[model samples]
Target chain A: MRIGLLKRHSAVFIVYVILAILILTTGLLSDVFLTFRNLENLLRQVAPLGFVSVGQTFAILTAGIDLSIGSVVSMTSVLTTGMIEGQQQLVLPVLVLVFGLAILIGFINGTIISKTGVHPLIVTLGMMSVVQGGILLYTKAPTGSVPISYDFVAWGNVWKIPFPILLFASVATIAIIFLRLTVFGRYVYATGGNEEVARLSGIKTGRVKTIVYMICSFTAALTGIMLASRMGMGDPLVGERYMLDSIIPVLIGGTRLTGGVGGVAGTIGGIFIFIILSNALNLLDVTAYWQWIVEGLVVIVSVSLYFRQKR
Target chain B: MQVAVSKRLQRSPQHIRSLFERFGIYIFLAILIVTASLVSPNFLKPQNLKDILNQSAALGMVAIGQTFVILIGGGGLDLSVASVMSTVAVIMAHNTEGQNSLFIPVMGVCLLFGIIVGFINGTLITKRKVQPFMATLGMMIIVQGIRFLYTKGMPKGEFPPIQRYLATGDIGSVPTSIISLAVMVIIALFVLRKTTFGRKVYAIGGNVNTARLCGYNIDFTIISVYMISGFMASIAGLYLAGWIGISDNWVGKGYELDSIAAVVMGGTTFEGGRGGVLGTIVGVLIVMMLYNIVLLLGMPVQMQFVVKGVVIILATSFYASFRRTQT
Candidate 1:
């Protein structure tokens, strides 16, 4: 029975093993890799994607993709910083506006997919284009600054841990619990596992999916805010790569791209693996160009591994 | 009496919906043309028409490639095509450097790269079982990175006059580019509509398992489809290099999405095996005209992106609804 269980859960098991191997390899390859400073910095850098991955986990859980996450991040970064403009007093209002816009975008995405039966990829692709254009129309150049007060969230530390890491941990914990221990979570799994069967089982599959999308955009918005805080400026192009980057972690961490077979714990491991891999590259003096090759190879290999495990 | 009239209107929407699928984009293209002529007297001039056709030729080639992959279905998409175009543009420009002696070799290399990339993409998806989206997406990222590394973020070189003439120069008052494009389209339509391979493509797209069961070499067919896509992208890249008179890393930035929009808008169902090359060309023409309209109206350049986005959403939704009704 135990052997059979291990066989079934082998993908997640492999991810953990991979994570461990990455840690050991990096540590042996670079003296600083095992140090607290490097670890903390890695966690801090992983924060934005960490949060985004949690939300992506939900979307993928429902057999849908959220391509607009990157655009949402871009829009949110622009909106938050553009509105704040270094004014501490406007931070709250700007955040509210950003989240509200994110929610609205999510609603539009979910409703259209649900009502029209158009594929989520196309719907989100359209949304990405609209948001991207909106960002350009709003400003051809990077505009506005994040308030200095917001630095606490981006750079602050508590109990020797950076706040972003703390934020990611908190979000991941709640998500893991929500997905593993709740009725709605099960519905999400059911919907993704087999939508037709889920519907016949009386699940409000549409609502479940719509809510999942909302969660996705909400987290992405939060990541954007965090990114703006870190950079202290709003740049339209900053979020262009996040959509691809976020999906990688989810896929590598054993969250099935086909949906219904993964969770937050696996995603956390995925994020760690990515962070360590990138850090290793940086430590080994790899240039930005070579990093791309390595990243692509990693995706191909990890995905292939996933398929092999399933077989 | 009011209910009867309302009922009649409601019933006509179904008629209207099908009409839109079959000819809506063409109608929109016509309306836009009329509107453009009314807005700017220069619009109907031969020079302007030539400019539009020239631009469409470059974009249309890419769309044809996109249509093929999407037609082959099974979540088929070629995200790397645009990136491949960019890389080839750089390679050709840098290697040839306006030297006629070097042109043939560079062209050969570019086409070779296209085939290699397409083969890799096909193998990754089919043999490795990576989702098509993920495979192409990974390739796109990797290729872009490689290009950046090769160019060091700055692309240099120019198209030789001979190449330039093919792209923009006219031959006896007829643009060679458009003529070439017309011939290519004719060839594509013939192959897609008349050949055994075309039938196999449709069979796999309509249902992959059924196609496999019917003894079609599913893997070979899919790989060939992507190879065609890659080759078409290389052609677009060459034309764009000549048309723009420069080679840059950013040249192919948005062609993937634009090609997808064109294919979907052309009534080629995303579910595949339902549309043809002729419709895609018309779709490309519609997109081309929309850009012209923006220029004529002097609208913010960004508004074109917005308009394109909205059009994609509306077009896809309309098609999906129509398909749903048919089923």
Candidate 2:
């Protein structure tokens, strides 16, 4: 029975194993790698990606991708900071406005994709273009500032553990429960597993797909807000990396691009794997160029290995 | 054959509907041209029209290849084309130094690199069971990284004499780039129209399992399709570098999504097997005109992207709904 359980979760085990090897190597190479201060910095730095990946997990779970996630983050960061402009009193209203825009973008993307039966990639890609253009029109350069008191989400610590980590944990925990315990979550799996079958089985696959995309943009917006607080300002391109990088963790987490498989448990590990690798690379004085190469190779190699192990 | 003819005759309603699929892009093009001319008097001038055609040559080449990849669709999109284009541009700009003698070897290396990238992409998807998006997206990142590392973050230089001649020089008062693109378009049209490989591409896209049962080599055809896409992207990069007269890593930056957008707007369904390169040329023209008109209007360059996105959504949704009605 134990062996059967192990066989089922072999992908998760492989991911964690890779993470262990990466951590060991990184710690051995950098004397400060395991230090509390550096680890905290790493967690804080990766908070944005952490939130983005959870949203992406939902989208990919439905066999759809959200290329607009990065741009949504970009627009939110820029808009939030642009509106906040160093005023503590304005933060609440601006954030509400920013998330509302995010929701609308998600709604349009989901509607076009589900109702029209168009590919999610194309819809999100179009949305990416629109948001990118809108951001550019709004500001060509980094603009606006946030009030100093608004840093608790990204910088402040509770019980010596950073607030970002706590926030990420809560968000990720919510995703895990939503996916594991809810009928809606099973509907996502069923939809992704086979949309035709899911439809015939009485699941509103279109609505499921739409809501998943909305969930994705919502988390991406959360990441954008945290990032704006962390940076105290917004750059139009600040969220650019989240687009592809968000998918990497999910892929490394053993989530198939084909969807209906994998979970958030593995994704959290995947996010750490990425953060630690980049952190180690920074400490080792390697040029940042190699990190992309390494990431690309890791994605291809890790996914292939998981596939083989499944067989 | 008589029964098939009768069935097709009975489906004349869809045939009339498919006219929209066939000529809808042209109608859209006419509207844009009219709007453009009304917005800017110079838009209808010969020089502006030629300029639009000239600009489209590079995207036209890449989009033709994108058409092939999208034609045989099982999530078979090549996200790596942009990086491939940029890598070629960087290489030519970094190495040429205006020396035409180095053209042969450099072109060979660029084309070879393109093939290697395509081979890696195809093998991963076909043999390793990796999804197409995952495999190609990884290649895109890797290629971009390799280019940047080789250039050490910045590449510098201009194209050789031949590329310059092609970029700005005219043959018989028509731009050489246009002629070059025209030649390729004719060849692509003929191949897609009359060749065995072309039929197989559509066949595979129509139904992979049925194609497999019919003894078609699914893996080989898919791989070849990617190779074609890579080759065309590299070719586009060369022309783009010359036309722009310099190289920046961002030169080929937006081509991947842009080419996909163009191909889709040309009435090619993502489900595949429905569009051809001939339609893609018209698609390329419409896209280029939008860019030119936006520039002519002195609008913020970003709105070009916004318009492109709007057009893509509208075209895809229209086609998608129409396709559903047909069935």
Candidate 3:
């Protein structure tokens, strides 16, 4: 019985082991890497991606991807920063507007995909471009700053835990519980596993898909707001990297491309594993060009192992 | 009435499908030309038409290769083709820098590299049974990384003079690139129409399980298709390098999406086994013309992406509806 449990949970086990190795190696290689300040910095750096990955887990578990997340992030950042722009009273309204926009984009993606039966890749690829363009055109590269009070809400630490990190943890916890204990979550997995079977079983497959997309976009918006607060500035190009980063953690978390399995806990581990590796490489003063190669190699190796294990 | 209806249905032979298919391509081309002309007066001008054709030439090459892969179906996607183009262009540029005699040798190297990358992609997808999306996505990342590393984030070197001429020179009011494109299209059309390998491609994409049962070399066809795609991608890269007169690490970025979009818009079903090079040429022209129209409207660069994205979805929806009615 114990061995069976171990076999089924091997993905998490592997992730933990990898994280441990990365942490230990980084500690040995650079004095700065193991310091409290550096650790705090790393936590903050990974916080936005952590939020995005939680949302991505929902979409990927439904056998769909959210390429619009990065653009959504950019849009939210620009919207929030532009609206508030040092006005403390407008912060709440800006957040609401950003979240609303996220939901709108998500619904659009879901509706178009489900109604048209077009592949998610094509749908989201189009959305990515559209959203990015929307943000750029609307903002017109205007420079703006977030209000200080909102920054406090976004960047303030409670007892040494950064607000963003705490937010990420709470979101992750909620996601894990939702997946493990909710019927909607089970439906999501079932739908991804076999769409026809799930539909025949009377699941509201369309609603489930639509909701997941909404959640993915919403989280992306939330992450963007947090990032805007952290940086105190809104830049159009800021969210460009999240599209790839979000997927890397989800893939590393052992989610099959065909979908239906994996959870946020494993994804958290995967996120840390990537963060630590990248952080360590930076600490070692690796060239930025070489760093890209190493990062790419790492993702390839992790995914290759995933396929090998599947076989 | 019943007898007449039955007779009409029966009289339409399988050959009718071919005729209908040919008609669809022509109709689509006509619609594209009319729409572009209606949208902008400058769209039909000879210079603009030549520009559209020149732009379409590179994308069309990549789309032709994409047609082969998609024809094989099985959720196959080649997202790394653009990255491969960038890498090949950089390699070719670096090797042939300021050397006239070395141009052909450098191009030979680029072609070989393209084949190797395509072979790896094929093996990973077929032999390893990786999902085509993930495999190609990973390869995309890897190649992009390698490109960045090779160029160290900055592009250096220049295209050979002869190579540059191939991209920029005009022959009797037609771009040299267009001539090259025409030759490639002819070769591709010949291969598709007259070769056994081409027949096998359609057969495999039409129904893989049946193709396997019939003892077709499924693996070989898949690999070769990817190899052909890679080779075409490299050639496109070389032309881009020559045309632009400079090579960058980011060259060909987002081109994979454009290529896939053109192929799908060309009436090639994502489900596979139902497209031709002729439709792809029309598709390429439509895409290039759309870009030119947007530029003519003086739209901002950012809005161009939005328009392009909307056009892709709209085109796919249009084709989807058209196909549904036919079936």
Candidate 4:
């Protein structure tokens, strides 16, 4: 009877099974696969994307998408590194200003989308171009570096655990609580589930949507800062993958891309699955080109499964 | 008879609105042209005009397909178009080995490949119940991966002269590409206006359940729309390869965005079932002109993105207000 109940909400369960199989296979195939050091490194590797996916969770929960999240991340990275300029004393102030700017961009995106009734995809795509172009115009190439002191956010650990993993866990925990416990979080799901019904029920659907998009962009900005700290330098092109990559895990985690039916728990499993898959491929020394094929197939199969499950 | 009478009775206000919507893009295009000529003497040069038209033809072709899909309106979009274009170009280059004789067979293969891709996309959306955006996006990724593997991350071969002639060759000073674009647009306009299929597309876009009750083959129509999109994308890919005389992985990198912006700017609401190829052509020209003006003003390329963003926002707001007033 308990197992039957578990099966009913077993999207996360299936993901765990797949993840375990992946880990087991990799552990058997490679000598270094199960090492604590390597596993820790993999967790750190997934952190930036993990953060962005959390943001996507909110946006998708609200029935809109932030295509500009990747661009915002890229721009944030550029601005952070540009402002920090390797000056240790400048990191804090510069980061504050960058975050402020990112939030402002998010606000503009939210306002335009909600007020004008423009499709979120188009609005965010336009914003993506603007941000990317602005970054390119500001620095034709990678131009500045963050201070070395900031490396702890990307690399350093407390009590043998990586800081990024710690950061991701806390953020995920907060997100879980916000989604499960808060009125506003429920409003987001309500808004996505049926905007008209939610509105008639006294929810400010527009505001909910705008705030969700803002949160999405804000997290993306945070990711950019982390990436900048990790690389020690900002490259204008680094965040391009986030546009698609961030959304993939959310979908794979059984969060409906159409919106309103899933949460962050599945996302964590999705992240682990992807990180482990990539790590296994790396261990197998698969060519990069073939890896693309594998990743694409995985997304297609998982999405097909999700659609079937929904039906 | 009652329906006809009501449509006739409602025609006056609708006529004025439709007239404005149809011709408004032309007015906007004319204004941009006048401004460009005034600001930059180079803009009026016959060669430059031809260059602009030639450049827009490829994008215009893709936008026509986008118009068809958007016209059907169940969140119909083919993000895979750009990826399809890139993969077709890579296949052509690899198969032809840059030999002029093999170009014809390779072109046939490209079209076949497009049909296969379109079939997959259409099937996924209709039969599998996948969202159009997600299905096409998945197709895009898959095609991109295929292209990468096929080219081994580095493509080789020069585009054939026969293909180049399609883009640059002229008949009585009119570029062949522009001429082909005009023919395609004419055929498209005729189909959308005069054919049963066109009516079905509009009917579906305007109201799916009603169309289904009225016995329209909704699934088939939707699939055909995607098929046309794939076909158009292949043609655009050929033009791009010929114009650039190279086969590269990112050949169609920005076409999906550019085509969407063009379709929207042409006054096709996201709600669908409105607008036509003429407006899309105007939209494409306007965007190309904007790029030209930015270049003439010696602005950096990055400014173009800002300009495009602002234009989209303003146009969308304008349409939103217009809809409000109408309501």
Name the top TM-score candidate. 2
CA lDDT, every model vs. true structure:
0.85, 0.87, 0.82, 0.84
Predicted structure with the largest lDDT when compared to the true one: 2
Worst 10 residues of 2 chain A by lDDT: A146-155
**Tens-digit per-residue lDDT, B229-303, candidate 1:** 888998888888788888788777778878887887787776778788988898888777777777767889988
| Model 2 per-residue lDDT tens digits across residues B83-177 | 99889988987888778999879988888888888888888988997777778888998898898898999788778989878877899989999
Question: What lDDT tens digits, residue by residue, belong to model 3 across residues B1-327?
Answer: 457545655865543453444355556668868987887898889988888888888888888888888878887768888988899889977877757799998999998988887898888878877667667777777888788878877778888899888988998888999999999999998897789999888888889999999999999998898888888888988888788878788677778988887777777776678787878888788777767878977887677778878877776665565454445
lDDT of 2 at B314: 81
Looking at candidate 3, what is the lDDT of residue A210? Answer: 90
Off by over 4 Å in 1: B1-20, B31-43
By lDDT, highest first, what's the ranking?
Answer: 2, 1, 4, 3
Candidate closest to the true structure, highest DockQ? 2
Alpha-carbon runs more than 4 Å astray in model 4: A1-14, B1-27
lDDT of 1 by residue, A258-298 (tens): 77898878888888888888899999898978888888877
Model 1 chain B: lowest-lDDT 10 consecutive positions: B13-22
Measured with C-alpha atoms, the lDDT of residue A104 in candidate 4 is: 84
- Model 2 chain B, poorest ten-residue lDDT window? B1-10
lDDT of 1 at B5: 51
